[model samples]
Target: MPRYLDRDRLALLAALVAPLAVAVVLLTFRAGLPNTSIALILVVIVVAVAANGNRLAGGLAALSAAVWFDFFFTQPYQRFAVTKSVDIQTAVLLLVVGLAVSQLAARARRLQVVAITDADYLARIHDTAELAQSAKEPDTVVDHVTAQLTTLLHLRGCRFEYGSLIGHPPRLEPDGTVVWGRKRWDVDRLGLPNREIELRTFGNGRFYGRFMLDPTPGTIPPLQARLVAVTLADQTGAAFGTVGSG
Candidate 1:
């Protein structure tokens, strides 16, 4: 069985049957011949299936219409066999055209959906980057990072730990080391197999404490990871200014 059919059999069935039902109603109750109305109804069915995010459903709808058209609309009503040559040719042409139209429309709809999803992702990333850049205080930055990470990646929690190199490394207390600068990554380590996104600011051959993200597996793609790294680096550079420049 096809994946789409397996995933959405009921929707596929509805897409296939609704147009035929409309055509039957048109033939039985409304008038003698459906004329252009039948074709319009079939087009509507294709559009509806495409709108529902199943391009295969559109093709299925077209196939169902061909079968229904031959059985009901063609001469010698309620029969699979067609007597007239022109009617047979017309049915074949209708089937071919409907299938082609549905396929093309479905492809366009799929592309549109992808474009919208990508646009939304970009917008959210941009907003997060802006918020990160605008944060002046350490606590504020940590809060923003935690909130954004939770919203963007749906993580359980986020905490940053500044290393010894940044400004001031956290001191080791009597029981454990008290890290002042480094954001805590202990919670992140609890989640298995996570990607650590590290962003660094380099000046005078020295690296500043950078932003880090522990992302869930398969949630962040390579290209997106690279982009986030670049954005964070840019934001850190803007915050600290050029340390070595004359």
Candidate 2:
């Protein structure tokens, strides 16, 4: 079960159990501590859970905290019923605040991931550009771009063809659109079509060659990554043009 359990499942389990454990520990001092204070403590727990997990995990933590608070700290102790209206308000706020905080935390996490990804994409482009500028042989640039595309697009393999192919395999356009058999394939929803996707390279308005990409099964690279791959191919094209002119 542990091997099968993913990160999300582990987070959800912690969300469901942490509040209950904390509530049980607080039960010892229930006679002295105010219910409001206990609710505050549970809110802290919910925030902690949300920070480490997703929105759903945060919400479950909040819900669990409220349930346990009602069961252990309310007027009718050891029961779910809450006799005081004040206790009811506290429970409701716990859920509401917990949910709101969870949403904010989730958004922050997403933004952080985007920032890291953007930085990495920039680095890949920068490195490839430098290599293209310094390398004398076009094969060097082609080989570098091929390796980069395989990793960037999560491809099984990538190879460079010296000239344009005769048949119309799916083409990855400059604008990062995938054209397959007279239709623009929805790479986002359907993943890359299970074929050798062609990413053509051009030098000074002339077609030099293409990079034939064999994507892994069910690999759906994001639009940003696809664009980076195109940019890398453009760098390769520029390198070919330089070598030809020289």
Candidate 3:
């Protein structure tokens, strides 16, 4: 599955399905004639809304039920405009139920999203911790970290550069090279001709180096940057241990 949720498609599907499901349920109970159960229809609407996780679906289901109830089930049937007091109460109740269910379902969906994000973040942290503990050589750690990051974020390619920043910034060729920033070290988003991601890593309050992604520019978002930072910091700390403060 794609990492991000496609809200537009979900909303569109909810809008289309809710009314159709309600219509089907209404038709099923119609054979009994004058025995239509408004409670059953409301239950169906609530289920549909909860299953779909959309407010639009719930609202549409409520409206469809109200219209069907007045025209088919109410006395002096076959008209939209309600004339009876009890019918008015039923319509009001349907609206309230639909809105309430939809609100609750939406809240649940939001929680599910947050949980998924947190899980991904924790998994990244676990991977970094494992790399820090297991790798004896800094290059081995860097290569392992790069491979893990590429797999985790689904990047086409990744490279890490190490060394102090001095002299003019090195030309960031299609391949990787270390470069100096104009001034103090910071994470600068470098734009390439094609859609590529460039992440600069800083550690111990100083610039370490750049993490380059293949092709174009602006491909990596902020969350990915933080993950890369954690992995890079692990590798950099390992490098310092091996080389003794380069």
Candidate 4:
């Protein structure tokens, strides 16, 4: 079995090297090929790299392609300086066009990933709603939501604390923000705290209980996942309200 480089590392390495390698091959025909055509070829390479990697890799590939194009194909062959005005324009345009296309490619990839993730989140919410509607007891709904949150948020454990707002643990708010004591916690950077974090559940504006989440150390769930967790809690709240009244 052969081990391959991870996507990020491979993409970054290609970004730094692919342009130079391609430019060297084009050097054989530099005398006959128009500089504009060479620049367009480099732009294509940038787009490919961007589609496969992150924004930083895409941007680096664009810069690398432009630099190599200037060095190899422009006037005063093998020099970085461009003696002709037209050659200079071509080089600049190559960089600009490459950067633009790379950005678009990266954004398209991101949108594709987000679209898939959103579909999964919607399915979870829909399933939870169905369970809440048909469940015989509110506790069943709470237990189900507990399991969902545990998996969704990558929590070490999750349990419901009924009544009384107990201690001032960190709270995951409806808007997906985390608050610890009086200040906002930076979940993206710091990850969730080691202690149990609370997500309160409400039924018809009445506080029912809280789900205390023990997060896996260094696990930082994305904002979308956090928002989905909040929605699931709300569904549990509705179930509680319905069962309590009945």
Candidate 5:
């Protein structure tokens, strides 16, 4: 999610604007349109807002529409006071319908996002397995690992650390370390923003090496990063085993 305002926040603002726009257009012919017809039209606008936004946004839109309708369309115009029971019914119905529609739309959007995420994860898993299979040598395996990780974690760059301790990879830490090249990775130092990470590769019950990575900002949450790190370590461990076995 963005640090600034998102679609939902904007929707709230839109809800406020929709009524004023509608009031301008509809009030022009307020004398010609029946109260019931105008009420139904306002309800339609509220429903649309709710469908495109969250529950709170929808509720706000409905309330605004009802308030405007009462002021401009009902008797005792330009006032908060309502005279007819029918007008009361109209406002209540509009608000109730808007809230209901917003709830349904919000649920649908959440499910849709989940479905897409699931599909993408499956694809990534398949690719990881395929890359692991094709890698025969340690360098090739390490290269593949780095590339896959860079893409998976939305990293800026990732490179394998091959040294004498290649067979003694570091243990996984709850708080992962960050690295970028030989110099310490820092936006202030590198003149740009980056999330650098260091993850060890342990395969076939022995350590292979570690990969230094710089991730894209705000892509993976802590829990998800740990999950990805574990998977990568498992794959790397398997590849290390294969290199020796071959």
Candidate 6:
């Protein structure tokens, strides 16, 4: 969404404009324009739209291209009703090619976006680790980790609580679905606001300290976020290695 037009609106405009542009191109070579040429042109349009992550617009462009082919290029010129079997086949092929190309292009675009998103997560984790490494005190490390975790998980609040933490056995849900108490977070109550996820900083069965995150509603913390939290907690614990528990 930009200042001028949102993504959906831009897609809609592309859907309407792209097919018309292709039709104009077809009109220039109306005669002797092979059925293959029309199909190729329409496919190019569909792919262009779909590559922009606008599959709905690509589908609309595909349909329009099919209609334009029948109306302008077929024997029944200026009409959608195609009489010749060959023309009918060309029209059908044009539509199928557009749709197929659009599907493939859209899937590629989605995968590209996912790849970029994962890269961002990695970059954030790396930066946060570097920041934590430079921190001198346990509280400073905890504050930095809390800030990073809050932003990463879209949580409401997060902080470190120092105390003797009770160890719980690692277990799964009653339904045997998702892991619940990984460290000390309840997974059964997923999507519930104010849910706290506390990970212990201590390693080797020693009680050091704990960091807690209050997840915002509607956010089921991803696995990467959990891993990062656990790692941050460990780093914080190491910084407070010899300090007395709060």
Model 2 Cα displacement at 158 (Å)?
Answer: 0.6
Locate the minimum summed-lDDT window of 10 residues in model 1.
170-179
Mind giving the per-residue lDDT tens digits that candidate 5 earns over 1-246? 873348778789978999768977998898898876676666566656665667787788878987888788778988987899877766665555444334434444443321112323333433454455556665666676677777766677878775324332223342222333433333323332343455776666676667776656645433334344445555666667776634
Is candidate 1 or 2 superior in lDDT?
Answer: 2
What is the C-alpha local distance difference test score of candidate 3? 0.49
lDDT per model vs. reference: 0.49, 0.77, 0.49, 0.79, 0.59, 0.61
Which residue ranges in model 4 land beyond 4 Å of their true spot? 1-117
Off by over 4 Å in 6: 1-5, 113-246
lDDT of 2 at 197: 92
TM-score of 3: 0.36
Error of 2 at 243 (Å): 1.7
Q: Model 4 Cα displacement at 140 (Å)?
A: 0.8
lDDT of 4 at 242: 83
**Model 3 segments beyond 4 Å from truth?**
1-13, 31-36, 113-246
The estimated TM-scores of all candidates read 0.39, 0.52, 0.36, 0.53, 0.42, 0.43
**Candidate 6 residue pairs in backbone clash:** none
Backbone clashes in each candidate structure, one number apiece? Answer: 11, 0, 6, 0, 2, 0
Candidate 3 residue-wise lDDT at 16: 52
For candidate 1, lDDT tens digit of each residue in 141-234? 4455456545554444445544323333332221111223454433223432254444444434455454454556544332222333333344
lDDT per residue as tens, model 4, 1-246: 233237767889999999999999988888898876687777778877887777788899989998999888877877889999878766776765566556555765664433112436645665676677668899999989999999999999999998769878999986677999899999889998899999999999998999999999989998768877887888888888888834
